[model samples]
Target: MSFGTEMENKDFKSTFSGYSKVEVDQFIAKMMVEFNSLSRENNNLKKDNESNQEKINYYMTLEKTMQNSMEIAQKTLKFSQNQAEKAKAHADKEADHIILKAKEKAKAILDHTNEKNELLKNEYDKYYNEFETFKIRVANFIEVQKNVFSTSPEDLELSPLDLTSFEEYVLKNIADSSEEVDDDELTLPELFDDEIDHNEDAQEHDDNLVKG
Candidate 1:
């Protein structure tokens, strides 16, 4: 019989030389004590095993959670990198536009300065040419007037003192009559057949103008 069935049945075979009844009963009692101790130990071992299994399951769950957190962190880092790249690109584009605008502004300013300088140079050349023409016209007029007076016929007769006073009056009137003359509006004398020299008169007039 199985050990468990034998223990429960407690039936013993009797013979003419069987063991003592009290001794057998005592042995059975001792065996039952040992079996009961083993049963309690087995139950404690089962409880320990169950506790170990529960710990293993909790550790598995924690590991899975840690893995998920790592994945999330990686994804966040990638997203941030993408955003940084985009922001940098935008900043670069804006900087290029600003640089281009500054270049255009500088070019415009340079072109305007060049144009203004050209206009000033042209005006200076024009004024110099007009002054030269005015000087030539004045010299020609003085030469013609000198020649006409030197060759003129003398018809009027008067006292020497009266003639002197009349000449002075005429010179004063001619000197004062043409103040603020415009060269552009002046009517030049007709050209003579030959060139006339008025270098001395021109030099004297220029000196007088400078002194005034």
Candidate 2:
């Protein structure tokens, strides 16, 4: 039918035509050798394909691992940045709070100082006013005393010289008398009782004579 079939039929005819046994045996050996060589070559090609597939699989796995590692690194970097931002914001808020507290305390201290200064100033003014009043009263009293002394007669029953000396003597006596009175516990009214009694007696005597 075909060339291959025709060749196979011819080969069969030749085999049956009583060829020599040595020649037939040699032909079978040559065919076996060719079959064994083709089978070894096919096995070698199959082994080479399997090795190449294993290398491709290994390289693909390595690529996937590198991609996963990159993703993890990116996520970590983003988280770190967020944490840093939060920390900075918190620090800024705390710093503002501290500054506000300091300002309030400083204001309170200044207010207290100002109040104390005002109080001290008021007390100084009050004391100064009282001192001025006392000075004025003392000066007026001294001026009145000077006028009285200047208007008094020179040769009256109490001479000027005597009055001056007597005033000093009386002042000294009064100081001494005050010291004695403090120790004696004497009252002012009781000290003048004898002089008042003598005056009443003289008046009563005159009234009796006038009535007679």
Candidate 3:
């Protein structure tokens, strides 16, 4: 039977043979108080367990969220590194290309300068040769004139053909060596012409003497 029914139906044979009613009643009351206290404790323990489970679930979810955030951060870092490497490579390539272009330009400038120098040297040589030739011709003309002036008047009258030949030689040398000179100090050609005029005047004087 239930504890309540047992408590209610508990009988006594008589006052002398059975237990005292007051003592039994006090013991049953004490047991009922202990059972109620134990029940309250068990209910409190169940509530605590549920609260702890909820806290555990919240912490687990937070951990999962943190893990996902870490993954994203790592991906971002890797992507940034890759982009930096690409940028550096591109910069290096552009720098190399610029350097190569600068070298090529420098080489072209040097080549053109060398070619211009060669042309200037050739022109200088040509002018030098012409100047030397002009000086030689002038000297030859001067020598011929000197020889004509040294001859006697009688010799000139007798060898008129030799005088003509000397005159022709001077004219031919001057004509062959004539060139435009860009100097004011050189007066050989003009002096040679004056000498030729003087020789012609002397020849006319000798002719007048012969006729007289």
TM-score of each: 0.58, 0.53, 0.58
Arrange candidates by lDDT, highest first: which order?
3, 1, 2
Which digits, one per residue and each the tens of the lDDT, describe model 2 over residues 3-73? 33343334434457688867776776666567667767877988998998898899999999999999999
Instruction: Return the top candidate by lDDT.
Output: 3
Cα-based lDDT for every prediction: 0.64, 0.62, 0.69
lDDT of 1 by residue, 60-152 (tens): 999999999999999999999999999999999999999999999999999998997786678557656655655665554565456435543
TM-score of 3: 0.58
Per-residue lDDT value at 175 in model 1: 39
Q: What C-alpha lDDT, on a 0 to 100 scale, does residue 182 get in candidate 1?
A: 40
What would the TM-score be for candidate 1 when compared with the true structure?
Answer: 0.58
